[model samples]
Target: MFRILIVEDDEVITKALCKQIETWGYIGKGIHDFNHVLDEFNEFDPHLVLMDITLPFYNGYYWCTEIRKTSKVPLIFISSASDNMNIIMAMNMGGDDFVAKPFDLNVLIAKVQALLRRTYDFSTVQNNLEVHGAVLNLNDTTLNYENQKIDLTKNEVRILSTLMENSNRFVSRDEMMQALWETDEFIDDNTLTVNVARLRKKLEEAGLENFIITKKGIGYRIAE
Candidate 1:
């Protein structure tokens, strides 16, 4: 049975959501500490998350990005804020689906089941990219090197994958940003720099120093 995490702040609504989720034959868990959403998320390792746009400490977008930092678990937004911008933002933030408030419980279940099928049914999916001794797990956005699992954000995963996949080539900043599928819409060159710096630090910690080379004025690449 798949576990579901409910991040809704409404006491009565969350209770109902959890009860409904259990009736569908899935385990439902909620977080008491709104500030430590990720803590509960990492601990539970739920297969899917039901997140509300409105919360106590932070909104759903913030938590989505936080979860996207490491796990690519299926996330469905559940909130009354069902505007066009919110839907687009949810998609951009890696949410799998969205359901507006006052929704039918069965509809939510259908979406969750469909997403689960789409995500988990791919039995032959390439979950890892390996170069040298380092392994990058695409599913969870983590780097495995020397028996260590180093967590990576979504941006870092894209950057590293672009370089490694291209092999002996310098990937330009524009290309890097484009690799993420939303360059101007979300990130800039400076943002790329920060992500690369953080990725390099994590890589170094995993004992893979000098893995990425700077082409200065051009872009970056993995030394051939």
Candidate 2:
């Protein structure tokens, strides 16, 4: 089932929207800590985001751009502003659509369904990995961090993907070698070490420090 993240601050509206989502056969998650919206967002990995223009901490536009740096997920702005300027600004901030507040539940569901169909129907399932604000794009083998994008090599991609998949679990050197063995290239001990070191350097250069932890004799892991 597709998951939707709702960032509306109004408790009454959030409750009503959650009901509408369930009625339409979709799961809905409401934001509790507006300060950590992105953290919850990364954890939930929602298929689409319903954002409000006016928020307590940063506005929806700020979060939308931050999300756009790493994901192409659909973002729809929902606010009572409904002004032409707000609509245009939302679009400029990479919002897929706009839903004025005090809206009809049925209409909101319809717009969400249409956007979901348009986005995911023609694309592969997106990856949901993050480190220092950089997202590993599994579908395209790209690393996006702070709006800067980088192409990952096959070996680099595998190493990072494996580490991210088991973020809190220590992955032994042998396990990493085994992961590399699945590739077309025959990997040796030196080759695996070289690739891993290179990957670490790349991640570090991208503003991620101590991302991959070495568990002395145990293996490696991305510290949660």
TM-score of every prediction relative to native:
0.59, 0.57
Clashing pairs in 1: none
Regions of candidate 2 where Cα sits further than 4 Å from its true position? 124-224
Q: Encode model 1's per-residue lDDT on 1-224: one tens digit a residue.
A: 88999998888888887888889898998889999999999999998999998898899999999998777788999989899999999889988788999999888888888877655543236777888888887766678888898887667888898888877778888899888753223787777888899989988878899999998888898876
Which pairs of residues have clashing backbones in candidate 2? none
lDDT at 150 for candidate 2?
74
The candidate that wins on TM-score is 1
What digit string (tens of lDDT, one per residue) describes model 2 on residues 1-224? 89999988999999999999988899999999999989989999999999999999999999998998877788999999999999999998988899997899999999999888755553355455776577988655678888877777767887887888788689988999887876547898789889988888887887777878887789888867
Tell me how far the alpha carbon of residue 48 in candidate 2 is from the true structure, in angstroms, after superposition.
0.2
Show the lowest summed lDDT stretch of 10 residues, model 1: 116-125
Predictions: Cα RMSD each: 6.3, 13.3
